[model samples]
Target: MDIPLPTIAVVGLGTMGTGIAEVLARAGREVIGIDISDAAARRAARALEASTARAVGRGRISAAERRAVLARFRTFSDLRAAADAGLVIEVVPESYETKLGVLRALDGIVAPSAVLATGTNALSVTRLAAESARPERVLGLHFFHPAPVMRLVEVVSSVLTSDRAVAAVTALARELGKEPVAVGDRPGFVADGLLFGYLNQAAAMYECGYASREDIDAAMRLGCGLPMGPLALLDLIGVDTARTVLDAMHAASHDRLHAPSPVLRQLVDAGLTGRKAGRGFYTYEAPGSAVPVPDALTPSPAAGAVPGRQVASVGVVGSGTMASGIAEVFAVAGYGVVLTARSPEKAAAARERIAASLARSVDRGRISAGARDATLARIVPAGSADALAEVDLAVEAVAEDLEVKRRLFATLDKVCRPGAVLATTTSSLPVVACARATSRPADVVGMHFFNPAPAMKLVEVVRTVLTCDEAHATVREVAATVRKHPVDCGDRAGFIVNALLFPYLNNAVKMVGEHYATPDDIDAAMKLGGGYPMGPFELLDVVGLDVSLAIERALHREFRDPGLAPAPLLEHLVAAGCLGRKTGRGFREYGRR
Candidate 1:
């Protein structure tokens, strides 16, 4: 049976509360918005009006519709006025005492069957429910900040919350046009538990100078296709709220990963609570603004570059998926591409795979049939590394092992011309040792492309001290030619992307390991709570568990830091062959049962 949309009362008209109220009223439900004081209530009303006016100004809503929403919404000076409401959601400040008072007050006034929901991010929903007179009706309806826009809503059921209460709230969330995921009441619930833990780790990375803010962000945005980088997200979420949420999750879970990064606390204490305070991981233009001006404190770009190589042809070695993708990228960029494999048949198969991939792109309108044919025309398959001798540049997209990479570099050095630039597509191994295998060490640099190389944007150009200016310059030019953003860095393991991204993902794994929250909850937190494109665990599965563990191993080995060590959960998952989306299992299962 369909229940009519309940008249909703939003207690505590702060940013989140006001937005939620506006959303309800805009949906044609009568909304009673309350704050502690008249001034705050008036401010919330004005804010709601301004937001709706902007929608009208932008031509998204007509003037009459805007007026209807404003008229339907009410600002309450007294709690008793909310008695007529059928559902009351508390969006007060995240203080336990403040929330308790509102819930207790509402219990005294509203009908026993009226649903009670809290829009809490971190505090235990069960504990808050216990404080209410009608515990069975009290539950957590965790809304993402800026409640009018973000799509996700966590429908949390406390130990005492009734199934009917949960159903009503779920329906309400859907009525408000948001996706709802149900979870048991717990600290950080679904979103903050996973989001803050990762954000804290990113802050810790920034404090340790693992990578620059721009590169750290670029890694996730371009490398993983995330909507925003961790540091920048921390700034947007406000370091103060992030620090508090971290502290709360740590208190509840006692997981090291959930512990607030010392830098987060320091920044908040110093009055740099991200965009709200004009500074945090990066400085912002003003409070609540997303544009952050780079500060002097942020790291300068890596020094030095390699000179350009004058090769008209390029050789790409390997028969694996990445190898085929790399060959395709070079071919599409108009380079005469020579692809190599162990046997003639294997090389031919790799060429066929590249053709198939380009065919899909053509079908998707990303490329033209003529362009695909042109790219295929530029490719030639070789049976051995000896075929790379005539090419001006050779990029090895071989297996991610030191021994195999060393052997490949040793062979390339012997086969390729003296001045031909040598490059590795290794995301984790140090480029220096690979370069050292060749007599002209300066000729080797890393040209790392993300998975599905033809589609992803970032390419980390890692240059060792031994790498000559000409070699670095050549890779950068190649990156540009392939329509990739090339960011230069020194020859360190993990380079820029994995160096910063993996640790954050690894930290989330640890948080789940310690039972901070469920895998579903953790993933939701980052996607909803932090506005990331995908949750940390979701990314881990997509990147492959084994691949992430290898990168974590490289980073831990290079820094010798216990913090970078791969979580036991990751080791267990890898050992079980739950390698991620490829294997149909990881932090979360993928594909049909």
Candidate 2:
């Protein structure tokens, strides 16, 4: 049975509180919105009105519905008005004294069964609950900032929180049209505990000048498919808030990973709190907007080979997944493509797969059937590299063996026209070695695409020392032609994305290795707390243990750093043939469904 929607009161009409109130009122709940003063309350009320009005403008809400929502909200100057409310969500400042005061006041006025919830993102829900007379009734309703827009809300329950309280609040969250994941009360709960640590470390890398801010941000946004770069997100979340949460998490976890970043504190001290102060990691046009202008001090783009532009015909060798994906990407970009396979049967199968994928795109309304047919028409399948003679660009997405790649490039050089750009989609092999395979080393570059190439947007255009300036520019142009974000980086073992991303993933594995948390807990913490689409363990399974281990091994070999060594656990999984979804087993058992 559905619990009746409670007469909800959201206390403290601050940024988070107002947003929460807006969500409740918009959801047809009878809401009481309160603040310390009338003026502050009015401003929050106005903000809510504007928010709903915009929803109406967007046709998300009818004008009549918006008016009804306004009528449902009641503003108050006194705290006692919330006494009869079945639930009071406290979204006050993140201070123990302040929260304790709110709870103690609510204890005296609220009915015996009324639930008291706090919107603390990282604070200990248990400690906060203990401040109330009825500890079991107190729990956390951790909502992301701009609560109405972000879909996730972590429903946190302390050890002392009552089962009924958790269940009721979880139901309430669903009523408000949000996805609620119940989590244990802990420092940082599920999301921020893992997320802030990663953000703090990324800041550390930026501070040390390991890479430029743009490159660092691009590495995640473009390289890893994150919604935003860490630095930019740090700014949006506010450096001050980040510092406070980092300090709280570090103090509680006692783990060095949760340490507060020094740069965060320094920026806070400089009054560059974040969007609130109009500055932080990156300058924002306003407190809550993302229109970013390049900071004059922003680092220059990393040095790399130039890409050539005159390519009219492209050759994609190999009919495996990557090669088929490459052919599709180029074909859709309107380039004449020669797709080769080891045998005619394999080439025919690859063409069928590509056509099926394109048909699916048409079904989803992303492309017209005619356009799909035209794109497929651009690809001419062949049985050997000999047909690549007239191609201006030859990209080998073949198997990863070094000798196999060397042999492919050597054959391409013999058959392809002079001045043809040679590229490799190898994620781990050194670009310099691939370049050495070609007589025109200056034309060979790395055009690394993530798996399921048609869907992923990043293309790491890696340049070797010998690669010409035109080669790098040409790669960037090709990336743009294929509608991908091109990030230029020098020849490094794992390049930018894997170099930074794998280490963090490995650290999470290390955390599990040390028995800090179960695999489910770790993954849940990241997805719920950090807002990542998938958890580290889930992503590990998708990427395959063998592939990840190979990249880790390459990084370790090149850097000779013990820290970069592949985890023994990962190697054991690979040895067991539990290589993620492909093998239906890995860190977690798959195929059970």
Candidate 3:
């Protein structure tokens, strides 16, 4: 059995409304597009004709189909024109009073059996339903920007919303070629709830001088595989709109993470709303331009170069995954590498791992067989710390334990040449703590790499207060030699990525604990609305709930900020041994081999 497509009435001819009307018309539905101003109605009609012509030009639709689609659309400036519509959707500004006014007006004009919907991202659908007489018929059909292109539509159902009403919209979404996820009526629903918190945190990081905007964005793009950085995404989604969503979510949950950063308010106040206004965190070429040029506020990349000693040969100490990856990175860059492990057996295991990794790279056409052989030839495996005697640099990538790392650095300080730059690949523990362990504190630096180091491009070059200009330059130069993007920062708790990332993940856990929305819905919201590569829970599962908790705890312990504390849900999950994919369970279940 199939449900009949309804004649749709879209009240409002703004960007969202016009896009929705175009979608409906293309789907062969009789679409009545309404606007209060005559000029706005005329403009929408012209826009539709132009858009359809472009579609024809792109060969997306035949000229006959374009004419047919245009004939299905009817533009009007009066509300009574929708009296016969089976469904009426209001797509006005995201303001409670404005939407409520539109809904009340639609309630009087549409038939008693007609379904009423709003395209709101953050407002309360339940409260909006109460304003109409037929509350059971009211729900939310939230389409993302450029509704015709984006495939997601959140079919939100309030407590008073009838299942029949929800089913109607869900079917309508499928008819119009959109994916619909059923969500409960709440502020920001699923997507904005998890998204704005992350964006707000990025703004705070920039305001605090934690890192430059470019570095902050690059960290996420290279580190997490996101399509765009948070700051740039914020610019795409206007600053004023982001603030409105954040204010609404904060009002509902009272979570500090949702509170808008002061810089956001200042930007909006300064008329730098975003791409729509021509200037934001980054200035645009013109209003509504997608391309962004460097603004006066862009921070310079890495302080002026320092005259440092050349790094020709490197030593990597450990038997762990990170250690092997680091050794491989250096060897492939034409640097002689000495990899040391505690025993002959462990050294053999590290060699095998690196060999298998290189073999895979060769099979994938990422490197030639000759290049792989040459890279492997550059690595020298040793079973003792004495092998690092003459290397220009030695990096300790052993473990996260402070005592273990400190012991290695002390040994390196004793064995390596005095001018050799000693670095630690610690992601959480302070670089200075490692520096204090070595005799040559001025030569100690931090080079933090994301997992699967050979593939991920980011390397946060951390410098302690005692680190000399020469040491910093050597590490930065090495990072560039390995074709990694280096961002310099002072010794800090989580560096840039973990400091900004973990808190956002922790907030998602709290949202789940509070029963605000289902995990799947939250994940879909973030992916569809924010264009993130993965949802917070999905990432938590992949990274391991236990590992995430440890990082969050370290962040809280160092900063003493209550907001950074690990969520109770995370603690319980870790304690219950639902570690993640390794344990076959975490926030979601996984199939084990």
After superposition, candidate 3 runs with Cα above 4 Å error: 1-5, 300-304
Write candidate 3's Cα lDDT for 85-114 as tens digits.
889989988889999988888889888778
Model 3's TM-score against the true structure: 0.95
lDDT of 2 at 363: 93
Question: Of the candidates shown, which would achieve the greatest lDDT relative to the real structure?
Answer: 3
Across 465-537, the per-residue lDDT of candidate 2 in tens digits comes to: 8999887788888888889888767787877788777866776776677665667877765664466778899
Error of 3 at 124 (Å): 1.6
Quote the lDDT for 227 in model 3. Answer: 86
**TM-score of each model, in listed order:** 0.85, 0.80, 0.95
Q: lDDT values of the candidates?
A: 0.84, 0.83, 0.88
| True-structure lDDT of candidate 2 | 0.83
TM-score of 2: 0.80
Task: Tell me the alpha-carbon RMSD of every candidate.
Answer: 3.9, 4.7, 2.1
